[model samples]
Target: MKFIDSAGVEFNCPVTFTGTVTTTPSSPATASYMVKRWVSPTITQADLTGGQASQSVNLTGFPGGVVLAASYLQTTATSSSSNGGTTGATLSLGISGSTQAYLATGANVLGAAARLSNAAGTLLGTYRASDVPQVTITATGGSPDLAHLTLSCRAVVYYLEVTAES
Candidate 1:
């Protein structure tokens, strides 16, 4: 089969699975993996108007389960020196709530241009299913950011649904 893109919309590629792929036996299909789409708002000057801006997604899944993986895909490039400001702009992605830093990987930071999944400098550790998921962008180069006009992108969250007995 082949992956299909929606009309005028696309992205949020699935994470590449490698190594030993294990699927344990369980009842009620516990420990099963899943993915969710999180369409983000356009990263515009307003987001960085005050030097920072952000978008987020509240994940819903089994409480005892864990987030398997997460990624960001920039579909439409920003105007220039994008993301938030003309320069010194950075982005971060990870789980929200108490475990905010659970996936604070620099690999997800938006670069000089609109960055894709910056899943580096950190490990995708125990991101609890009870937590929310999202991304935050900041600007350190200008007052009332003007260069970051339009940045279109989406994110994908992979999770495992689990139960205590499973």
Candidate 2:
């Protein structure tokens, strides 16, 4: 049973989930994983050349009220051209907004109306329909022959809920 407003008003709190990623250095240079609406064994498309590389994955469609904590690179490359290299990756997470993309604080947080965050546990920004979250990886450190290596990731999902109003 539930209450109503006017004739029978009802509101939904929202569904949210959060998580992080960590990378490290390894041999053969291969990475693949899935998160949110993204699946593993995927490839990233090159912006300049429109070429696809087998070292990227994307997640989509959140059930609202989801928040991502953090994403650390234990051992991974930022670009496919520099895959399997000694360099580190600088990753960026983008959230969906009404007409623009918002960057998250700590990791990636998906909430009602589509929002993002990376502030360790705070809401970084919000998004609306037609907008989607994007993750970018850049390379740093000593460069190695990463052309032959593959990319992959291990995604972790988190869930939280609010029982009563305070």
TM-scores of the candidates in the order shown = 0.48, 0.31
- Residue 94 error for model 2, in Å? 4.3
Q: 7, model 1: CA deviation in Å? A: 32
Residues forming the 10-long window of minimal summed lDDT in candidate 2: 107-116
Q: Rate the local accuracy (lDDT) of all candidates.
A: 0.44, 0.32
lDDT of 1: 0.44
lDDT of 1 by residue, 27-124 (tens): 22655544433344444444444333344433343233554545554535543454433454445555554223433434323333454655431425
Q: Give one digit per residue, the lDDT tens place, for model 2 in 23-115.
A: 333321534222333321222332222222212224455335433423322112333333434344333444423111222223311111122
- Candidate 1: segments with Cα more than 4 A from true spot: 1-64, 73-75, 79-85, 95-115, 121-123, 142-148
Model 2 RMSD in Å is 16.8
Scored by TM-score, the top model is 1
Candidate 2 wrongly placed segments (more than 4 Å): 1-58, 66-86, 94-121, 124-133, 141-149, 161-166
